[model samples]
Target: MVKHLIDEQINLNLLTPEKTLFTGEVSMVVIPAEEGELGVLPKHAPFATTLRAGEVKIYHNDNVSDVFTISGGFAEIVNNKCEIVADGILL
Candidate 1:
């Protein structure tokens, strides 16, 4: 089991070929995983997966959310950090 610290946030990096879209710590991230939707929090087990075409929801401070749409991409989760490389990101 992953022992997560309270008040700790997950390190998130959203990147596109053109540039890095976002970089910061978030309370959680809801991603459109290939198999299904996936929710990630701090200290999540390491995993690599393909992202589906849909909206990526990033949750931070209570009630705060950032939404982004992407066609497809890849995501890696490890050591409480998630890095996303999207094929296309809709602003």
Candidate 2:
């Protein structure tokens, strides 16, 4: 069970051409995609994916949470970190 568990920290960065909109650490992330929603956790497999215009849910420590609407963008998950480069972002 311990070996199967991914017990690493995760950070998310939501950015646009103008500036970075949101940046924080979280336990999980849910992104809207063309096919369906994708969930990511710590130490997840490296991936580069397209994100659809929808809500991006972030689950932080202490049960805190935040949601943002992204028009469209790309998401990359690697080395326990997730970075999102989007065109439009609204919180």
Candidate 3:
């Protein structure tokens, strides 16, 4: 059996006690950072960083996509997986 790769998009609410904003597969993701925007792709290195209030771009395939704004939060990357825990999210 072959182990398939699974890509996931994670969103959360910081204000709420426990709220899952969004979770699914995405072609690409752009995270807003203090320095600027950061792009994430498959097999990305393990990383952890803080996010600023700004637009988060979610790319599905080539033409399909969506954008959301996050107040603030933390993001972690490990094992080719990306996880984002945010305060507030708006799309």
Q: Give the TM-score of candidate 1.
A: 0.88
- Best TM-score among the predictions, by candidate number: 1
lDDT of each: 0.86, 0.80, 0.66
Candidate 2: stretches off by over 4 Å:
1-8, 61-64
Q: Per-prediction count of colliding residue pairs? A: 0, 0, 2
Best by lDDT: 1
For residues 1-91, write the lDDT of model 2, one tens digit per residue: 1333334458899888999877877777888876789888778899999988998888754343878898989999998889998879765
Candidate 1 overall lDDT versus native: 0.86
Global local distance difference test of model 3:
0.66
* lDDT, model 2: 0.80
- Candidate closer to the true structure by lDDT (higher is better), 1 or 2: 1
What range of 10 consecutive residues in model 3 has the weakest lDDT sum? 1-10
Scored against the true structure, residue 6 in model 3 reaches a CA lDDT of 32
Query: Against the hidden reference, what TM-scores do the models get?
Result: 0.88, 0.82, 0.74
Off by over 4 Å in 1: 1-6
